[model samples]
Target: MTPWTTLLVPDILRRICEYQRGIYEDVVPFRRFLSNGATVHGTSKQAQAFESVLSPWLALYPSISRLVASYEPIKHALACHCAYTGRAGILQHLHKRYILQSVAVNLCQMAIAGQRLDVLEYLVCIGYELPRQFESVYLSWKDQAVFDFVFEHYRPLCTTNTTIYAFASSGNEDALMRLLSYVDEAQIRLMWSVAASHGHVELARTIYTASVDISDHVYQFAGSSFFSTTFQHIKNAANVGSIDGMFWIYDIANPFFSQEDRIAVVGFCLKYAVMENLWDRVWTLLEQADGRVDYPQLLACLPYFKWPQDESNARSMLSSTPALIPMFCTSWLPTIKDQAKRRLLEEELMSMAVLYHDGDRLEAREWLGDVDEYYFNAMEWLMDEYCIDKSIAHDVFQGPLGVAAMKRAIENDHIATMRLLLKYGVQIVPEYIFRRGGIRAIKFYLDKVNPEFTIPVDLLVEMASTPTNDTVFQIVHRTWRARTSITIVHTVESQCIAQAEAHGQVNIIIYLAKSFQSVHSPSEYETFLIQHVQDFYCAFNRARHGVNQLFAIWNPVLDACFNVEFILESLDSLLALTEENLKRLVSLSFVHIPTELIVQCALTNSVLAWRVFCILLDAKIKDKSSRMELQRECLVKKYEGRKFRNVPTVDGLGF
Candidate 1:
């Protein structure tokens, strides 16, 4: 499916360009009706504008039956907008729909491809209500085995699922049952499992079946987090009074056995159930176990056995009451590989819930923080060697309250730790991290410590000069090979310009802007600047909600400088200032440029990209001759290394 990005609304402008009619006048009249939020996005404007151009496409009542036979354009549009996240959302939303339609189909296709549920639901509603005859051939639900039969021909009349993954994970019985008619069986199973694990108790109960297999495949796919939660839900069921669920668990889960894992499973089940005063049931289960149990099992059972006797019955069970011990029985705590040993240990640990210093790792984990390395070690050992898979470790490591790992790395100032995490796919600056913390740690690491991880200088210069009158301009202007990740957090381009402008770093500014232009069309940059006219102008609405005062301090080269005095004499003619100006920016790099001046040139544009980006990529600068050749193409001037200042220095002097 083509993205809405395909027919860049800019194309409409192009279409208008070929006409001699009063197009701008017509658009200008309705401009007052556009969005009031901000001009840069023009999101509201685009919506209004689209209604006129696209309304005719939606004139018919039927929507899905008219989706474009080809989806290339919508697909292309979204890709252009950097809307990959949107596409994934859409696919999960309307994947069940089938119709040889045009307008509504295009919207649905885009909605599904972009994973846009809101748009998808809206389109689907339109498709279903404004009824149309869907080509019967296209309405084949037979091939779409995932969804229920009704959804094959049309979307459901109502959309209770607001989130992309919401209905997919609804624990509500009615919702799940209703949703089954719309989505695939596998999807329904996943939704049920995910919802159940998330503590949607009623929903989980509604979905769980006596015959359903506890799938190892599902466990592996959902990861330990899901299973851990599922286990927690099972433990909580009896406490909550779900009779059907409790009986179902008892009937399905043979938590005890005589020959094998009986004690561990039975003890765990009893812990939750007995806590609620189900004494008779407990005694019945214990009697059922009979001769299969041992002294420890008997002791564990005695707690509830005497629940009829007194609360001390639980205490008696916990102490192992020396009187209950056989003459030959060992009194000391035991550890072993078999379930018998584990069952005894689990009882001991549970016993410690009221006592202390059991020397049992699980007990210690509950009572203390991670201050003890010994406990952590025991935990690691239990997890790695005991569990068939290392899933248990993942379970113990959640709740994420303290980022001990990140904190430890910061304290040690360990570059290796950072690399290791990167290798393990831990993001130091995850998007959420930046949103909450706002690069404080990153800034500290970059500015204070001379950590071994540094980015390239040209990128900095490009960013520095891009935003005029920026604080900490000196940091950006330095022509260094290594820099920390702090500077690249935002506005690498603008920062380069800010840095260059702060230090009169023209060469850097030119290179950086130009580099930004090459891969993306130059017109895009121009459009962005025009769109952001107000953001660049705080005091004056350059376009609206402009950024700073400087962009408006025009060199008279621009036809309409926003609020600042126009340097009419100094300004280059507006025509001469085309998208070609974008060729002056530079990208971030790690490689060291030989001459600081050469480095400066690299920051200006694609012309200098040869030296800096290549160096950044390969970790080595290009040969002097090749660099000089690139310098010539980018600068549009001859290079005699020393002609300007010095052969090696980018600065005006002969460093």
Candidate 2:
């Protein structure tokens, strides 16, 4: 009917040959929406609107290609919007071919409105000068949104003060570049001043090099955020000529920088110190401050900086040295309300450091510095916070202390404190207090510290036989015997059995073996037998029906820790397996497998299983792969050792 309508609608409807529309919104006629394009490569119902406009003109050109070049951009833009923006039934007569600038401006609008960059980049290559907003798209979404808000609100092309200042305040170098193209020289100058005032030196440098009058145009807004940020930007500019420009700003507004801004200025000056490393210029700043910069930074490198005081050289000189870190230690002890209390706290800390500075074991162990309280207080001070703060003595000191305090606690037989401390890095070197208290406790850290901090094993053994305070050396003999290299297993065995008989501390053997493992691998059967032997002996050592709850509880803890897998591979484990499980060992050997299967098949007795596991582990440590795989397979198969012989079946036995 109209020139914009196409006859293809009739052809497509004829091909459909059916009308199917449903009452439900869920169902709609499909033929009306289907594309009937067959010969056309890129044209479809999606482009039907543009095609309708083209249909009337088609007889004049007689070929689609003749008119395609002029209409491509509009089609692509519409297609992109329809596909991505979820808009439908757009106008069909969009012109495709476009001048670069028009397309670029259109793309710039799209980019600022949050369109994807890939689509914008396509527009750029096809002849768009590519607006800076597209580049700022690479930044974070918040930055892009902020820039968009400035551009949308300001209307920069009209050259208003609000628009110019908004762009300057936005801190978007890309958006500022776009603004420069449309705005007047005076507007740009105001922008430069605002940027400089805001510490955006980099942005100012970009604008100045792009041929705007740097000095002449920007001076009208001399006292704004632009002024300050501009000077810093110019100073940071890579070109040597920009340096002179930055200094010129400094001459006019030297005191304009705020106190915090001055710190930034100081930092910038320090950054340039490599040029004049002799420290002559820096010394002047320090003298002006009377050597006290008062920045609260402990490592502030300016030594001459001090609180304005006359001739405190001796104190000031050493303050530059790092040993003065102790001067800050008073700041370390937890919290105090009054500044006067803080001074008192620092005094106490300096005195504490002195008391512990020498090799006083007790003082070293009783480390008074409350690191936890200090940490929490530092965190609180940062947040300008308070937490109904606990008393310094009760919250910090009265509670179990840190790692260093644990040593003193153990030395003093402070059991609960020692356990809490053991959870951390603080170690217990057995040589110090192995005789007096739980001797295994010394072995706790000894095994870990053993390789690096070597302790004499001979001394440990000797101490067991002859110790200070007439205390027996519990760990020395047991530890030395479990080692692969010690070979002195019998001596410790005899000593342990005798001690267990004499003092009835039979469980000491198992505890000793556990301690010994940290020093060396348990290689010997007899050495591993320690736990089993202790277990066997403990049953007799018990009074009657049930074990003492104290010992029973300790037994389960040991049981949970004892590795049954290792025990299953040992000779002892082999003897203890079910008779049938042991018979399967022969079959496994025929299949070129290990006999450990038989040992592992046995029902696990808590003590026996653990001890054997340790022995077998020592054997397995030498080979990790093939054996490990087989062990895994055995576990997966649940192949406990073989069953007993079935009435001497010769056929099954392969007789």
Candidate 3:
């Protein structure tokens, strides 16, 4: 029996309808009244907003025919999806079936989003009213073809600067130039400000070239208390890190401002560029200022450039501008409110300098204001010629500061430096060191330390799960095997797998799953498999519910399990591929599941099976793999002799 013919079976249809109703219970409250296929006028505003938000999700509906039979308010929503995905046949079916009204506005926008001119032309032919809010449409349209089509067909009324501003914000220079012909030359200030603020450098340049200067033109800055008579747009461009636009404005307005005003402008650019971490712009502004900027005030903005996140740029600042570190130490460090964080940043700065250049540089030594700071700086550079003298080594290694410096060395994976620290009797908590350090440091520590101080198994698991510590994790596994007395406890193993999956550590998941199976009987391992899968699902569902959809899409468990044969085998054994579960898997937005597996598990007791079948078909189409095609042929051969009815034929597989 064909798959689509099987969908026509009454029992299958009823089962699918029940499943869809259960899955979409949250969408029921958003329904609008439909009278003779036309939308009624008096729905609540909240319902309308819900409809807009649910439109994209509804397009992912498994059964379009079932959707038409049961849900009425969402038919137009499906229309929007059809336009977005460029499914002309589905769109034509929806239009002929519903006579969808009050839809031209969204259809036009959807066509623009999808970059579908054919859909737009179809809408225009159907006599739907042209959209009146051209600014919204123009603001979103990026394709030149769609822009020209709308421009030529609709001929937007440029009665307000809002239209010009939206067009400029889209960064379509050709379209903006065409739009400027309709706008008055005197009212281009708003357009220019929007362009510059949004980093549309070319659009801002084009607008500035065509604008007429008014003697009394006082450009009012929105959402700010100040107004400017000259070069306000230049500052706006700088605020958004628009380097090209800033230079263009500087070239035109340089002669108009006084010396102090010029310094102020460059200083403003330097401050924001540092905060935005625009290193190239920062260097350009510093060079252009020609040593006129107040170094102390500039150093105060360093905190805004986030540490570790922008550590590379901070290092670049140190290398390119030699005066930055010196000024930061003398002027900025004293004013920082959090002295502890300030000291850490100070240590990292010195270590970074030592990383890039010789640690004996005078400027690096000068930044070490205190005795402890000197010890920390020397630890990173203490090799061969830069070795510390024996006289003070004992006192330096015995203090708590030395312990902190040791931890830093371990975290940085500085094996030679770590050996030096250990040589001088620097104290370390073995468990803490093992958790953070990589393989080389861990192996060195294990080899040097007494055997009785072997790291605990729990710490081993924690080490294995730490993000970006894969090499250390491998050594951890080997360490476990080396100590034959340590038994793998069930709870500890589960925790290791869960955390590794959460962090997306693929290697750890495979190692643990396969290793556990190897050590236990099939029956015992089956129970373990069931519990592990349950824990993963519970954790995954909790994460999906608590966080935004974008966050859930990157949930590490998905990547951790991707292409792992053990996980696929576990999922297959559990028969866990139901419609709801399939949807959850698809939302990962990555790989496609096996088609044969979906046929085996997703269609169980699903009388109206086409919806679930369609999802599998969609996944297969996207898979684009000849292996998946072979699997489909296998599935067809397996089910070909069954007496299913009314199922739709798949795209590639003939019924």
Candidate 4:
């Protein structure tokens, strides 16, 4: 036979055994599979190759068995597997070798946990001492057969109270009854406490029945304060939807609770009843309390209640208390989205207000402050439904009330409400409307409310500068059209043109430029156009120096000047300028053009480049000199060399 060294050295085998032992400790199912039959089939390719390498080594090195037997992890795993799988043969072999001593108690626990009576008996026959808390483990199992066997064979390891409490808490009726033969009244009361606290209603009832005096235990359980085991049990019962358990403690067990406890109990029941939509139960509890409970305290609890499934019952419960109308209006009405339900709530509120105020509008209006949103809703409701006089409705919208209502209406974009307030002689500032009412509301005011209203020039300029909507520009245009005096047109035209140029509104700039040209002479038009181009160039350069280079590119006035047709026409108007003014315009226009773009154009299209160069040359001729002509010739020759070099060669022949 081949020696184990041929397969692997002893050190390598020892390391492999150590790794397997570590795995055996943490992985129970894998340990069970190893003990059953350490077989590997249809595994991954890597696992198959690993097995092919390790199997021969493991077989040859039977010293691994002695190592495993002595190893703590392997001993534990074997004990657990034998106890769990009822493999007494393995347990007997391990015990004969004294390898099961380390895991004897754990093996007993596993046997009890798995209810393996045969393994337990074998473990006992092998002189395995049971743990002191073995009965605790036995009670947890709640298997009567195992408990009986453990009780008859093993000495009592746990007290009767611990046993009874465990049985009661586990809701094991048969095991609890079997243990009941040994429990006295105190233990029974303890069992009742545990059973009730754990939501074991039937077991609790049985224990309570077996107790001598239920009231003593109940009082002892409740202690001196409301935050006691009794209260906790009741609340837990309610939370778990165990109505019988909750009522058994509240009604049957302790009927004569204190006034505070009664109020608390009724409040809890009422809250649950309302949440569950138990209308009859809610009314019954309320009547039984008979005004003993604080209604506001009860009403405060209503918000914690869920929206009931049957909303009609919820409405009935709410309407049953007329004094809570304000609470409902302020607290609950806003959350309701259904129009019909809201209308129903409003009708209830209106009826309650009428009944309480005895048809006195001033009294009800005083009861509901004018600044409150609910008051406005009530006033609107009264005017619409009760046919209250418009003069009376108008009375509420005076002073602070009027301003508050108008502000809210504007904020909510309620145009109809604003119109209503205005009809009632409520004066509003146009500036306030412009500031808060946005462009639509501003337009509404201009077109419908007051056409003569004028926004300040500074504000109009600001609005034009960052015009979120084009309609603002249209509104400013309308204002300009309405008053076309020379000064007004010039001011409006200059502001609009500056803003349009700043925002890269080329189309708007073109339109304004045409308008300005139509109203002014050619010289005035040329002067204003140059001023606009200069302003745009200054703003663009300032933006380029800041973090707004992208804005600079988008708002480049040179691009606008080239793209806008009306701008070209305006530039044509400048064709008859003085020599100095032409030079200035040509310099300003070329200053903003990127040099790289000019070079690319000069190389790719020499004709266009020459045309631009000739234009510049003509503009510079006011102080014509030989130096200027020589410099222009040098620039032309430089571009010509670049253009010729860019031409492709076809078969060594330039194309």
TM-score-superior candidate, 1 or 2: 2
- Give candidate 4's TM-score: 0.37
Q: In order, how many clashes per candidate?
A: 90, 31, 14, 0
lDDT of 1 by residue, 1-655 (tens): 1224322343453344345224433442233323233232243234435554443323322221122222223322222121212433333223334322421223333333333444445445545332333222222222232123234434442222332135433344544566555554345445554454455646655554411433322222233343344344345444554533543444433432222444444445554445556655555555454313344544444344322243344433334322232211222222234666554443333222212234442221222222222323333333344442333233322223123444444333344433333333344542222222223344444554434544455534444534332322333333232343445533555654454545444444444444444535656666544543332322222122111223323212133333322211111211122223311111113212234444443444443434333433223334666645554453433243436443443222111
Superposition error at 624 for model 3 (Å)? 99
What is candidate 4's lDDT per residue for 481-589, written digit by digit as tens?
6755555767776886677557655445555666676767977876676567654443433332221222222233444365322222232222333344334445654
lDDT of each: 0.36, 0.40, 0.55, 0.54
The residue ranges of model 4 lying beyond 4 angstroms of the native Cα positions read: 1-65, 68-77, 99-105, 125-129, 132-142, 151-171, 181-203, 213-219, 222-232, 235-240, 252-267, 275-655
What is residue 250's positional error in candidate 2, in angstroms? 29
Q: What digit string (tens of lDDT, one per residue) describes model 3 on residues 75-183?
A: 7556765665566767776677666564323665555555678887887787754566533433335556766776777766333455565566667667666766566
Could you tell which candidate, 1 or 2, scores higher by lDDT? Answer: 2
Ranking by lDDT: 3, 4, 2, 1
* Candidate with best TM-score: 4
Winning candidate number (lDDT): 3
> Which lDDT tens digits does candidate 2 get at residues 1-655?
3311222343322222233212111221222222332212223333344444334434332232222332333334334333222222221222243333432234333333343444444444445443332233222234565446435543432245554555565666776777676766556666665565555656766776673443443333334575465555545431343333343344334455655555454444432331334244444434332333333333343343332231233233322222333323323324345666655444333223212333434233342233323322332332232222323322223332343455565455554445443433445545555654444345444454353343355555445334233223444554444452556554554454445434434344344444544555545433445445444334334323222331332333333333333323344434454434433332221222235543353224455554443344334444756545544554444434656454333233221
Q: If ranked by TM-score, best first, what sequence of candidates would result?
A: 4, 3, 2, 1
Error of 2 at 201 (Å): 18
**Candidate 4, position 591, lDDT:** 34
For candidate 2, report its TM-score.
0.25
TM-scores, all candidates, are: 0.24, 0.25, 0.32, 0.37
